[model samples]
Target: MKIKSLITALAAGMVLSTTAVKAEGNAFRCAEGETYYMNVMVSGVEYWFPVYEMFKQAAHSMGCKTAYTGTPEYDVNKQIASFDQVLAKKPAGILVHPMNSDPFIEPINRAVESGVPVVTFAADSPNSKRISYVTSDNNREGAYAADVIAKALGGKGEYGILENPGQDNHDKRVAAFIARMAEKYPDIKLVARAASNQDPTKAYNAVLTMAQAHPDLGALFMPEANSALGAAQAAQELGGKIKVMNADVNGKILDMIKQGQVYGAINPNQGMQGYMGFMLLFLAAHPDLIDPMNDYKRASYNPMGLPVVDNGFAVVTKDNADDFYWDAYLKRRGTKGIEE
Candidate 1:
């Protein structure tokens, strides 16, 4: 689809409409002393920017301020330290995507105990004291990918996975996909599983190695978009026989899907995650609003419980690939929120 047509589709959804929504809202006051922060490792990754942008949008709409700060590289210790550093400044609240589940337990606990509301997004620490967790249902995403690919191949072929192990969300995706295949399509054999670390080159090399090992491999799945780029290139070079499916979408991935270089993608509603994440933190931070049922100053328990929000996802193929582009969404929304 052309950029113009995509914009029209988005406008029809009422998400954003060329300055229509932005102009009407004074709900976001940006009042003095009302600021928040988002902390995550791998801030440089393409998938994260939209989440952060929508977080900002939610903050702005709610009359608050937000800033982005986290390690540019994927280093757990560094991210933890950055979390502590952000704590010292004491923003209204924080939304963090921990590199690992247990490593973030201490920092998240300390943040909550110190009265700084915290929520986790994308990746989460279930053992931690964070007030809320927001993300797509990763298990559902993996199952959907498996269903799409297995049915596309008619359920009797070998497939492989390019995995980024240990990260909670990525691990869940891989595990769920494997389980789905085993239970529903026993005829399909999983030929290989290799580490990609969310790197394009590594994924490229991994796919090539899988191809060499299983010459009759039918398909390959990765949990994230970055690795899909490399996997797509490798599939293209291998005469496009091995179908490639992955979770998440960006411009390049959508382009590949449209061009038939890649088969499909599972697109999480990342914007909804970001927006709801901020809302969770903000409400937790300011729990002074009167409750109709409860008496004044409800104490002991934090304002918000550790709720999990599954923002949901859409399966993207060539037929609707154009609707998932960030550039078109930004243009149609009429907000200069995210940079290309």
Candidate 2:
């Protein structure tokens, strides 16, 4: 709330932190003709495109260049090959968002050991020694989603969660949502938990099957974007028999929200993550001024605080959807704030 107010008046070339964006300061200023290159990594979903576009624009503004690459789907082998390609090019720095937390540890470690000043964004590789992570407080986000659903159901409805059970990020988010609901709302009953494998068709079938089998099911909570999209289709076909709450934003989901066909989404400030990732990498390569790992946090962060930066999320509903009008960077990427 406070942060939104601040952003309303931000001038060009300002870097928005949770607290403030300086008057004359910018995110970073690169040296003339400095070949600062970064690879923006992601495990592709509908959600990753906007983020990469944001990073690319930010790099351009700072007089640097960037390459965007990732596995188009959630394939470990494909992701590894992509990571290797980025490393082989030996960019000034690297920013990777791993598909799974543990499997990518070795590759991330190699990136760091080779002095690549890597930072994880969105989905993180926590076990690996990535410099910093930029993402929403996923647990907090889950709790928030649960709160919304519980209130909507009047605290006493039977519900189910369509989960991507093995992914650490999704697992933690779902767990947080569940724990918060149990702690705060006593009578809400959880009927079932289904793994949707982050597939839209699978989620649609699962939701259709569940709705048919359990006529009493009042709501469905989905934590992955594809599943959420599938659940949207199911909700549409079910003729409003079920209520849904889920994470991430997409063109399809935004339209569903506008039509009151699906519930709101918890959306990460992904553009900011890409913007910050570029800033961190640029700073790491150009400066002996601050130690990328130690000194930077001490200088510009809340010390008695959260370790990772919470870029925060804008809870998008029809009422507030207009607040997130497409920026120039988003338009350049061919996304008109959830337009199909």
Candidate 3:
């Protein structure tokens, strides 16, 4: 009896120890040299800095490595070349903001086939085999902006939109904004449209022309921050009659908001986008960690594949404009914005 009790106790101890070891081994941690890269077009833009900072923080906490790589120019071909270069290094995973949607299909599919997971953020390649997309709902952003503008204009006025036509997110914002205005706020008319192409000079020229054509332009909207700089300048020139609003903010945009030169901005939750993007990429890269009761196993698909994830957004007005400054964020973080 004594021998049997001792044997039973030993067996229980062995089972418990084995289970503990397995749990500890399965805990999320990167192996040595594991690295992820974030690739984008117009890499020098301040908008990407906060996103990358959060991405890097999440990677470091998991003991993984990360890099920021992209073309300084907005050229798609150059961005693709940079992506290919990053791929050549065989990173553990990649998070990319494709300049154009369809153009990225082949590259993103190629990466997935090569066993390197790719996740897209902000702008997405929806037709690609990229594992997931992390971004705010551009349609909602535009609809919300329309409401803000219409209410500010007392539900009846003229507004013009500056566009970046070829980009997916920008196109969605413009389309949704127009549709919402026509559907719900018919009294507010869209008088003009022009492609800013994210150029301040083009935006300046476009707004000036629109204002000249429709002197009753009570508000102007753009889908991005860079164009807002010039649009706000033109609005200022028009004696601040046009309320300039946009979808993103930089230091200058925030300053303009505080000074009431720009009405407000729809700022996406960039940090959540980055942090959740890394998590999605990591899980996609390590699919063995999950075993769901789904068709993924039989279909030979990534069980972790997510079609889209909305990180949400915030409205930045003069009251909260101080909280959205990138310089202050970088200073608090004690790190170079995107230099490293």
Candidate 4:
């Protein structure tokens, strides 16, 4: 596969519409006298703030109100409770990142069954009756990490993984990385797999333990950027031997990549995920405006369409780390071509 772009319009903090949305045209009509509310619900609150920001940007562009509500802790129960609380308001639609697949089915279905559309983002509850799912190709992200790390190590080295085991998307990334390594780079052995649960401190301790046990460990791959805080610190303290690789990018992670403390990152187009997720929810909720055959009642697919949006990803390294920073994205967003 060819190298992905350094930063796409969506990754640059510019709200992008997947397909042309008739936000105000005669083809689309808002619910009369009803204040349409859109919200994003997630578990790892801090890590997803940028995504919520972009979600707000999308809501702003569409002339609607949006809110962010979720648990800071990585607790599924807390997220579920938060979901319930958000549902009580009877918002127009919801965009949620379900922590696990099985636990979210009932709540998502309940929301949909009640006429409030829900779109899952980043992480999905695939079997749930969600109108749509929006995210990057996580399996390919893992495969990308495996390719980069293997090439960095000259195709042979012992590597460890800092995994968020139970989460569906993170698990897919870890499994794909391991499988890609085993299938394509047989000599690059996976020495240790530690459960970090998306916490940096836990990842730090896990890396320290793995380094102590493996000694020959050449690299470490984590599923998300937050864990890089600890993993990068551990690698830095370990005389800079164990290279750190992971998915997602942010201000701090990009700095680590520039300083060579972290190897590289696979950056998903989070802005697209947020913006398009809201779009999906809006479109799903307003099926009255969308119809292949000219009416939601007669259309075979409008509200119940199970569309999965691939927002795409990019591999970030020191060479283009500057492109993925939050500040740079802000500047780019101010530019004419990419502004929301």
Superposed model 1: Cα runs more than 4 Å off: 1-31, 290-299, 338-340
> What TM-score, computed on C-alpha atoms, does each candidate reach?
0.87, 0.80, 0.93, 0.84
Q: Positional deviation of 24 in candidate 4, in angstroms?
A: 8.2
Between prediction 1 and prediction 3, which has the larger lDDT?
3
Which candidate tops lDDT?
Answer: 3
Question: Looking at model 3, which ten-residue stretch has the lowest summed lDDT?
Answer: 22-31
Q: Pick the candidate with the highest TM-score.
A: 3
lDDT of each: 0.87, 0.73, 0.93, 0.80
Question: Which of candidates 2 and 3 reaches a greater lDDT?
Answer: 3
Ranking by TM-score: 3, 1, 4, 2
Task: Identify the superior model by TM-score, candidate 1 or candidate 2.
Answer: 1
Per-residue lDDT over 9-63 for candidate 2, one digit per residue giving the tens place of the 0 to 100 score:
6733254553254432444565555443333333435576666666676777877
Query: RMSD to native for every prediction?
Result: 9.9, 8.8, 3.9, 10.0
Task: Please estimate how well model 4 matches the true structure, expressed as its whole-model Cα lDDT.
Answer: 0.80
Tens-digit per-residue lDDT, 168-233, candidate 4: 899999999999999999999998988887789999999999999999999999998888889999
Output the TM-score of candidate 2. 0.80
Estimate candidate 1's RMSD in Å. Answer: 9.9
Q: How do these models rank on lDDT, best leading?
A: 3, 1, 4, 2
Looking at candidate 4, the ten consecutive residues that score lowest on lDDT are 33-42
Candidate 3 ranges beyond 4 A from true positions: 1-26
